[model samples]
Target chain A: MKIIVCVKQTLDTNASIEIKDGAIHAPGSARIMNPYDEFAVEEAVRIKENQPDTDITLITLGGENSRDILKTGLAMGADRAVHIIDSDLDDFDGLAIARKLYEVIKDREFDLVLCGRQAVDQDRAQVGPALSVLLDIPAITVVTKIDFSEDYSRVVATRQIEGGAERIESPLPLLATCQKGLNTPRLPSLKGIMAARKKEVVEITDLPNTAGSVENDAKLRILELSLPPQRKSAIMLEGQPLDMAKELAQALREKEKVL
Target chain B: MTDKSSIFVWIECQGEQIKPVSLEALHCGLQLSESSGQKVCAVLFCGSKVPDLSPLSDFAPHSLKVFSHGRWQDHNSQAVSSTFFKMIQEQSPRLILLPASNHGKELGALLSGLAQAPLASDCIEVECLGENDFKVKRPIYSGKAYASLALEGAGLHIITLRPNVFRGESGSATVLPEADINTTEPESLSLIVREVIKEAGKIDVTEARVVVSGGLGMQGPENFGLLEDLASVLGGTVGASRPVVDNGWRDYSNQVGQTGRSVSPDLYIACGISGAVQHIAGMSGSKCIVAINKDPNAAIFSVAQYGIVGDALEIVPLLTAEFKKILNG
Candidate 1:
């Protein structure tokens, strides 16, 4: 089976963020591979582990900083890596991204394409599904579990539903956006890291629009981005914590109107 | 003409009722249709029956179409795909808006594949750019930056709207002309839902207005009670970091961050949390942020408006007590 895992480098979630002059300031913070994408890479590599000849390619559309994320994938044992380098493409929307990616993977033969459900930062959560549409391939989204039959021609995937989960089966050459808890992504081992240095890491640029639709436009614009308002420190009372709690509860139930 | 009529918004139904996020999508859909001067419609599948459409009266949709499943009691991608395929063929709505929920995401992706339409997901905002073109904006880089996009292609444009970004507008309950409540049985039936182990007795962090979360600095599971007390005092829910959840100090459902649930509460208070980027991605959109940590340089304080650099065990109790006095009095 040939598998492709889409990975993205994301901002460190815990960085102390500052909005200065209408720009977000997240300096000196460490960046990491999107945790969700780790699951995608792990799953792809796991399938490769089960089938020794499986060719796993990790692809990312990002800047130099994204290398950290792709390296982690290589360290996790992906066979090859591809980085589409374009500085002007910093803010490509999911539609634009899907278009760019579809161009690269359209002719490639693959049994499965895996992506993290959503990148943590923007959380738009649209690329995998949109890619499926662009590719005209079936997609199993938010898949919590996936199992292939002996022939590796069909897949039975379990996905989260409204209150429960649903199991669906689809043919190969499909897309699946992996959700967390599907499998525990393994950590990069020392041997794997040394081997990753010798593996294939291809760099491509100026990939043309393969979809042939200049339909590249966005419907939403951020008028302004600002930090949320600060909260006032709580004022401590003198009574017993439990009694004060009851009074607080009554106030919430009565004055606040939840009751 | 703007091709304004025959707009369809996929209403994600939860059992017999529609999800609130779906209503938010309708609110967004109405705006898009109005800007482009088009009529709007709400599409659903036949089940128990469509719930109260009262919440969506604002957009004043020109139609409500219930595509039935004949006898199937659940939602299948192929069944929905075939139904939507038929609806699009009939109505030829220029734009189809879907909620970016798990189900909506799955079905929308699958439907777009079947129908061979353009699909966009997790869109935060949308505006009509030109004739049959829409500009969409969404946060990228873990909410650290933003991106703008344009969708221009063939006849049908399928897009998913992020929840919370479009607050549901309470519309006057008005009914509209109905479409076919049709049904179809899919061919793929390889598995069945054996049991649904619901994550019970816990508030959904994503939907909660106020959230108070803890992290490794919380010490241990026993120390979480103080945070819970604070949450109860504020009539809010409790959240935890990945470590806390992994250490069995909290349930995975209560975990908030990149690997967990993404939330946009009105207020998010971090007690003893160091504020990892993974954790912040989930709650950074909160309207208000308060960080209480012993270390003055804890990463959370960088984004926090008010910082209380002290022991959370000591401070959370006092903070809870203070809220009791102010909110109660």
Candidate 2:
């Protein structure tokens, strides 16, 4: 079995994000693999543990600093890493990014492709599904659990919906975007880190010129970016627990009218 | 694709009723149609037996198209997107609106890729600018900022609207004439649904009118029972911050944060929550917020309309008992 996992480098979730020059600037923010993508990498590694013949490859498309995440993926047991370095890639939208990813691995023989449900930064949750469409494969998003059939020909995936779970079975060569609760992503062990240092990191510079490709052009253009309006300070209710509860209840009924 | 005109809204139906978010999308479509002077078309996918379409008549859509198949019982993005692709090829509507549910978001992305259309996901506002253009406002940077985007293209413009933000309205109860119904079975479905397990009769945090959420301050998993009690008393739902969920104190579905469910309930009560930016991103849209934490400087207080600097373990039971007495008496 062969699996391809998509990983991205994103700002740490705990970083205090600030707005500077109409864009987000988290000063001294440490870059880590997307928290959700770690689940994808872990799922791939677990599959390899069960199926000894399974090969896991990590792919990422970004600038120079992106390889850090790929290296992290390699340390987490991915067999190899593919880095598509394009300095001009920062301006691409989700759809264009999916198209570029499709261009890179459309011909590869893989039974499954996995990605995080959504990146923390953009929160679009579009890339995996769009890439699946481009590759003409079925996609299940927000998947929490996955199991392979006895023959490894089909996989049963449990996906999270609004208030429930849906169990879907798909044949091989499907795409699944993983969500939380899928598994506890393991930290890279000392031995794994040592092995990763010796592994190969393949860098590719052959990207199709997206200028002539109509489908590769960005569909949505950002006209302006601004921070959300600051909220007013909370009106602190001072009193005993009973009195505070009474006042809160009264406020809910009289002022907020939510009760 | 010759000068597209009509606005098509995807109406998600389970059994005989339309989903609330889909109704909101329908209302959005109607509003856009008023400016575009285009017909508002409602697209529904139903199971083997076609459910009653009369429930949607109150909204007074110009036309209703039903896609009935056996496999439509569950959400199959591949099958649904295929149907939508065929519809787009046939009608070529200028605009497409869908609810920003899990299925809607996935289908919107799939259709956008298949149709090569510009898509705005989880949009809070959308306006149909004339001449094949639309302006949309959506949260970016994990709700830290809003990006005003313009979709200008020759293809369909797709927008998935966030639920609870768009107001739904019903027009005169006039039945819409049924347009062409497609009964084609999805071709070559690679995915199959094995089973669907749902938490029966429990209100989802996303759709709940009120939410009572806890965080690391809740101390442990058993402490969430206090939140559940309060939620039940208030006829609301129980939620948890990412840390609580990460600590295995609660299910991921109950997590309210940037990476979890984004909720905009009428009232949100944060108990013992420190209010990380990630968590605030999800519930900041609530109409009113109340925070109860021992720390006065908790970030959650900034967005909270009401605050009580106290221990959640002590205050939650008292608040729950008070509400019970007030309501019961």
Candidate 3:
């Protein structure tokens, strides 16, 4: 079985993200793999463990820093990596990103694809489904459980809904967006970490055989980045736990009228 | 059929009731219509049978449309997308607004790609800039920062409103003309839903009006009963932070924050949860937040509307008792 897993890098920011010159700047934050993508890679690796011959290819689009996630995927036991890097690609809308991924993977042979249900940075939840649309393949988003056929020709997956879960049955060459409950992502083993350094990673500067300009075709454009409107200052309750609880309950009913 | 330039709002329903976020999307549609002068069209999705339509009268959309099929007993969507594609081609709506929900966001994004339409998913605010143009706000970087997106020009546009952000309102009683739109055949779709698995009587944290959440401070899974008791007293649901969920102290469904569900409830009480940026990303939109953690410097307090510095193991029960006395008395 062949698999493709899409990963993204995100900023681990706290409450203080500053917007400087129309862009969000988190001064002291560290870059981390999009948490959802961790689940996707974990699932893909689990598949490879069950079927030793399975090949897991990790794909990510970003600047030079994006390679960190790719390296992380390698350490997590993926077989190879594809780095589609462009300085400006980081800010493109979901449709444009989907098109780029389509260009890179269109020729690849794969029976399955996986991605985090949504990227933590943009929180768009678009790429996986949009990529499926571009690839003309079926996509099951927010999938938490998956089972593959012995012949590798079909799959059954469970996905979350508003109030319930749906079990879907689909043929091979399908795309699934991984959700949190899918699996607990494993930390890279010491041996796996060392082996990752030697893994093969193909790098691409620009999308070859360009279909159309991603910028011109972008449906949505970012106007600016700014802090969300702040909530009013909190009222710190006083006294013992019992007194505080009574005051809070009263505040809920009388002050907020929410109860 | 409505005019070609209407703003179509996909009203998502489960069984007989409309999802709350769908109503919020309709509310967003009405607000957009007031500024754009476009009619608001409510499109209904039905299960094996068409649910009653009278409930929609309260929010009275300008026009109504329905698509029904047996396969839609759950969220079977291949047929649904085809039907949506057909409708878009024939009617050519100016804009489509769907709830940024599990099903709705995916469907909206798929349509965006198929149609190559510009889309902004999970937008908290939509302001009409001018004719056929708009500015939308969506939280990015896990709710730490918001991106203002612009959708301009004549091409079709789609926006998915975040759950619980927009307030629902009663629209004019316009006595809408209802129509049955065509549905794509389930046989042609590539997938099938074998069954729907749902925990009986479980309230989705995203859909709940109140949420009582726990984190690492709860110590262990066994202690979550304290949050459950508080949640029950408040008539809310239980939620958990990533640490607790990762530790297997709680199910992923109960997890809130980046990687889990983003919830914006009327009231959110965080217990033993030292707020992480990812957790705040999922819940900063909550109307009222109360944080109870031993450390006053826990990040959760900065976003909370009320803060109580104490051990959650003890504070939670006291709060539950107080709520019980207030509510039960």
Candidate 4:
């Protein structure tokens, strides 16, 4: 089985975001592989562990820095990597990116494709389902549990929904976007890190030009990026715990009326 | 097809009634229609038996479009997407608004892909720039930053509005036209839903008016009983920080953080939460926040409207008792 795992490099969640000159400042921000995509890579590696013949390939689309994330995926045990490098590509929306991804990997022979539920940067969660549509395959999003049939012809997946879960079944050549609680992703060992240095990374500089449709035009344009408005200073209530509790209760009833 | 412009809203049904988020989207759609001089159209996908559409009459949409397919009763993304896709092809609406629910997000992405339309997801605000143009505000970088996006093109503009952000409005009851029902099965569907396991009778934290959230300071799952008591008194829901969920102290559904659900409740009480950026991103949008922790320097106090520097274990029960006294009286 050949598996393609989509990975993206994102600003570390711990890093404080800063907007400068009408755009998000990327410099000085620590960039790591999107936290959710790590789960996808981990799941793919586990599948390779179970089926020794399974081949895992990591694919990414970003600027020059994206190669680092692909290399990190390689360190986590993907067999190879593909980097579609174009700074202009960053301006495209999720659907265009999905179309480009489909254009790149449509002819490749793969039994399964995996992606993160959503990128922390965009928080769109659109590419995986859009990619599945472009590829004309079945997709299940926010999947937490996946089980393959003994013959490897079908898969049963448990996906997270609002306030509940749903068990779904689909045939092979399916796509699933990973969510948290799927599995604990393992860090790359030193040996694996050293081996990743020699892994192959195929880079493409330009995307295929099938671009006359209205969808090919960038629909969503970023006008400005700004920090969220800060809240007013908190009123620290002083007194004994019981007294404070009474005061808070009175405030909720009298002021906030939320009680 | 007529050249008349219309704004379409996807009215999501939960059992017999409309979901609050979908109603909120309808409100947003109505606002957009008023601003752009377009008509408001509500689309409801149903099963064999149609839901009670009388309640929607209070919102006074110009028309209601019902697409009934047996498979739609269950939450099938393929069926919903195909139905909406067919409708979009038939009626080229100027804009499409959907709730930012799980099904909505999936269907939005699927329809965008199938129709090659552009989508703005989880938008907090939407503005009609002109006839076929829109400007939307959405939180990015885990709510730390807000990005203003402009959608301009000849094709359809799609947006998934976040819940609780838009205020729902009701006008004088106007009898709406009979829903135009279309019963068409999707051509091909490879996925099958085997079973659905729902968490019964639990107030979702995202929709809760009040939320009592615990964190690492919660110590263990047993300590959550105090929070449950407090939540019950406040008629609210219980939530936990990501660390608590990661430690297996609570179900993932109760988690509030960057990876989990973003909530904008009326009142949010944080107990022992240290307020990491990830956790803060989820609840900072609350209208009023009260933080209770032993540590005076806990970051949660920064965004909280009120702070009590004390032991949560001791204070939560006291607050619950006090609230019960005041509310019951």
Maximum-lDDT candidate: 4
Query: What DockQ does model 3 achieve?
Result: 0.61
Backbone clashes, candidate 4 = 0
Q: Write the per-residue lDDT of candidate 2 for residues A1-259, one digit (tens) a residue.
A: 9999998888887776777776678899899899889999999999999999999889998899999998889999999998999877743278778878888778688999999998888888888998898888889999999999999999999998877889999988999999998998999999999999988888989888342132412267888877777789899999898899988988887788888
Residue B269 CA displacement from its true place in model 1, Å: 5.7
| Residue B61, model 1, lDDT | 65
Best by DockQ: 4
* Model 4, span B11-97: residue lDDT tens: 988655677778788888888888887888899987777888877776767888887777767777876787677777788887889
Q: Scored by Cα lDDT, where does model 4 land?
A: 0.85
* Clash totals, every prediction: 33, 0, 1, 0
Interface RMSD of each: 5.9, 2.4, 2.8, 1.9
Q: Give lDDT tens digits, candidate 2, residues B120-177.
A: 8899888876656788998875676678888876567789998778866577777677
RMSD in order of candidates: 5.1, 2.5, 2.4, 1.9
Enumerate the candidates' DockQ scores in order: 0.22, 0.63, 0.61, 0.69
- Top candidate when judged by TM-score against the true structure: 4
lDDT of every model, 2 decimals? 0.71, 0.85, 0.84, 0.85
**What TM-score did chain B of candidate 1 earn?**
0.85
Runs in model 2 deviating more than 4 A are: A90-92, A209-218, B1-3, B52-55, B169-175, B321-329
- Model 3 reaches an interface RMSD of 2.8
Model 3: per-residue Cα lDDT over B1-329, one tens digit each: 56766889988887667877788888888888888888988988776577777666766678888777766666667766767877787788878999988889988988887777888988889988877788999887667778898998766788998887887657666564665654543556788888877777777898789999999999999999999989988879999998888788888888888767888899999998898877988899888899999998888998988999999999999998888889988
Model 2 residue A127 distance off true place after TM-score fit, in angstroms: 0.8
Q: Model 4's A-chain: what TM-score?
A: 0.94
Off-target runs (Cα >4 Å) in candidate 4 are A211-218, B1-4, B184-188
